[model samples]
Target chain A: MTDPAVEAAIARVHREEWARVVAALTRRFGDLDIAEEAAAEAFAVAVERWPRDGLPPNPGGWLSTTATRRAIDRIRRESQRMAKHQAALMLHDSTRPDPSGPVEDDRLRLVFTCCHPALSMEARVALTLRLIGGLTVAEIARAFLVQETTMAQRITRAKTKIRAAHIPYRVPSGQDIHERLAGVLAVVYLIFNEGYLASQGKDLLRVDLTEEAIRLGRLLLVLVPEDGEVAGLLALMLLTDARRSARVSATGELVTLQEQDRGAWDRGLIVEGQELVRERVRAVAAGAGPPGRYQLLAAINAVHTVAPSSSDTDWSQVLTLYDRLAALDPSPIVRLNRAVAVAELDGPAVALAQVDRLADGLDAYHALHATRADLLRRLGRSAESRTAYDRAIALAANPAERAYLTRRRDQLRG
Target chain B: MARYLLSVFGPTDPPASGGSSSRSELLQEWADTGAFNDKLQREGHFVFADGLEPASTATTVDGRGERPVFTDGPYLETKEHLGGFWVIEAADLDEALALAAEGSRACRGAVEVRPFNTPESIQALLDS
Candidate 1:
């Protein structure tokens, strides 16, 4: 096989089969370290032989079989009493016909365990990408702009913690499920936000993180179909990502939502997200529980995306959604966003007063300053606007955002 | 399963509740805490739990060198002295944290949980 073709085939198989292979190995071997190492070794073996031998008839099956063999080989290499027991189990399970099920419960267990609150947020993200998302340590490190060794250590330490602490390897039930499901959803959402807006980097977006997060969201939707928040989170990510192209200009300047080209926005994502929101609303009307945080967020984004242009956006409806969101999450950031809608409805003066009131809570937050600068500019207070813009530019981490703020500040009356 | 130290941090010198009703409330808190300890023992999670005297009564002695140095307060002279602690076995950190939450409520003080070092845990870290 040609090199590029073989490489592409391997990449595709790795993405499709990595999680399945890892989950299966973890279940059989009952050791994450063994599972992770064996899975990687199996993939390495594929990389070496695939080009020479061509793609397997069943890539996932081949990988799973190969990983099992590798795990057994590893266990046999060590003389630990525990390793021998695990090796016997793996040997026993490898011969049986694998059962087919509607849901991959092993992966579901892996997801909950990876996102367990006992792990640090950073560790959770790293582990999820590695174990469940099939991202290599190098790939994850590059995406997060960290060293490969550092990412490797983080993942290794997390796996050690899971084993040592005996973090249960199963989907939680009852009240534990509800609370822990929130953690899983939160990890996914955090991944999306990190991708949607690079906190401190040259790039405005990391497409890989966003794509991985969306894939996880979809997986959650399938694994736990009854959870409305899972669907809501997926919808929210889709709607937010739909605006990616319009979020940055050709010259790499960050574009505000009002200034973004509506035609450039992804209509397919918008339609899909809006449809999901409509479905949730219908479900709620049919006596389901009230919409969750993600659901309400998706609804707000739906309203924005549905508009033909910025001027056509229904500010009142946006404000209403914000009101509901505030009741659910009484965070300063939500109030700041709601104030943006208030500016459109009650004028810039009203919004400016509200923004000032949030200073104590959000003084160090660059977006707050950016919003203040904009409202002040709208109110024809150029001096105060310039001062606010200066603070915003100073505090902002993204180069693109600083560029945009600088341009806006320079445009004001000097 | 692993052992965790759930250390409760209370006021160094507890101020007396102003009224007689408040004093009764304190007694009620103690009774509740006693029940909680009983529940822990029943569940087989209890190892040892006890309250300590106020920080003012602490006496520390340092004999690291040949000439020993005596200190008046805690070993390190810190503000975060443990008011009480419970050493319990749990499946994982989640179980430990959950128990700590209950312990905090029962004692009406903040609780911190730390896993004890085990041979497996140390080996796992070294392997990593």
Candidate 2:
């Protein structure tokens, strides 16, 4: 007899593993609701029968198979109820292995669907978190620093938009693929930022979000092996994640790279990231295309990781990469980073000029003002730097960030 | 077997409601979540699930056995009120408790696990 304990265990698995199991099964079944319902039914069966039968050796796979069967049977039943339900049930018997082509194809399709352009950026994020990251509405809301009801509405809206628009759950082709790929890239970026700087919570970083973003980036790389930017993004995330071990202190205080213990960084992830960058750079060199933002960012990180110590950092090369990055993207943030590199490579005076030029665009950005203040103070312009420091303090978001900026301002005054 | 009910309580002060999304979008969310619940059912672990009406309509009753006295307040009056719940069967209290915890995590609400009285218990009461 299946142990009741085991059956209960399977039922719990159904709730936690529902999204993943459904995602994989839906790829086979081709209907969102059907796949979801089927997977749920499989869990229900687990609750009822698994206790008598005992736990299966491969629970996820078993759930997948059971859900798939349930989906087919559901479709058949629906057809009986409604004459309009004319679509054929995409059926594969429970015992057989899924064909590799459709399985692989379905994953790509799911990715495109989750990141579909038809959905707003917020909707895309909510959908991707729900479908791809397998997060519940409450978790997604917590991640976004919003109430659960608000997030639920957002996610529900996104799903409704997809359905009404009849957004096909398939990867785009031709010129459309380019647009969709950008959407995919944007989603990955959003995920990574949330991981890097959690909006709310005691911890500075959310490693789970970081890990999921990396996983998605890697998955994208696999889907489009020739896409240099995808690999670059993966490399960038890897290099950044590599430094996570040193990003916090023993007391959980945030540590800037300059003050970090380099020994704590993950050498394995760094090496892997470096290899990826090397491959992407070589491909870019072969006239595939100009290096994208991810490639440029990865190159900048590569500089930091390749150096044995902070003093060993090749500020000049990093400046050059930032220059290229600015030329390509031309964002206020990129210019601010460039100013920092210029401060190191040139001198505090030259860097101050760059910061002044960026000041107008980044007037409200705390870090930008802080950077300007640092350079001004170093250049013996104490009064001006103090003013800049005051501005930064007003704009600062967190206590640690404020403390760090305040300390610099104090040292300048001293 | 045991069953548990976990309710999610929203704030007592109702939110100043804003305009909802377009009808199509609202429908899609309903369809999507409806689909998700369907998955729950397929797993056979779905005991019972439903979203509740507003807590404002809730009525309270006290006393036992015969027709209990009725009141306007809830059964239990607290700042944080029960919103909704789920029922799941488990072998023992410990297992039931664990599932309840998971339910709490999923719903962000309190989960109370209680066993269903077996038929034997009814017969024992008659004998007594």
Question: lDDT tens string, model 1, B3-104?
Answer: 989999876777678899989889988998999899889998999999998887888888899998888877656666778899999876778888888888
Question: Which residue pairs show collisions in model 1?
Answer: none
Off by over 4 Å in 1: A81-104, B11-22, B55-73, B117-119, B122-128
DockQ of each: 0.48, 0.01
Q: Which residue ranges in model 2 land beyond 4 Å of their true spot?
A: A1-24, A27-30, A40-60, A72-104, A200-202, B1-128
For the second chain, the TM-scores of the candidates in order are 0.88, 0.58
Residue B68, candidate 2: how far off, in angstroms?
Answer: 53
Give a tens-digit lDDT track for model 1, residues A1-414: 459988999998888778878888887877788888999999999999999999899998999899989887876766554544565377536744457634446788889889998899999999999999989899999989999999999998898778767777767867889789999999999998888898867898989999999989988888888888888999999999999999999999999989999999998998888888999999999988998899999999999999988999999999999999999999999999999999999999999999999999999999999999999999999999999999999999999999999999999995
lDDT of 1 at A300: 94
Estimate, for each residue in A1-414, the C-alpha lDDT of model 2 and write its tens digit: 656577568646754466567667655554565665676578778777667777788787888888877876776775533222222123322423466543444556677888876567888888777776666678888877889999989876676544433456656766667766877988998888887876456567888788878877876787787778899899999999999978876765567788889999999999999999999888888888898889999999999999989889999999999989999999889888888888887899988887788877888798888888888888888999999889998987665566667777787754
* TM-score of chain A in every predicted structure: 0.94, 0.85
TM-score of chain B of 2: 0.58
Task: For candidate 2, report its TM-score.
Answer: 0.67
TM-score of every model versus the real structure: 0.91, 0.67
The Cα local distance difference test for each model comes to 0.88, 0.73
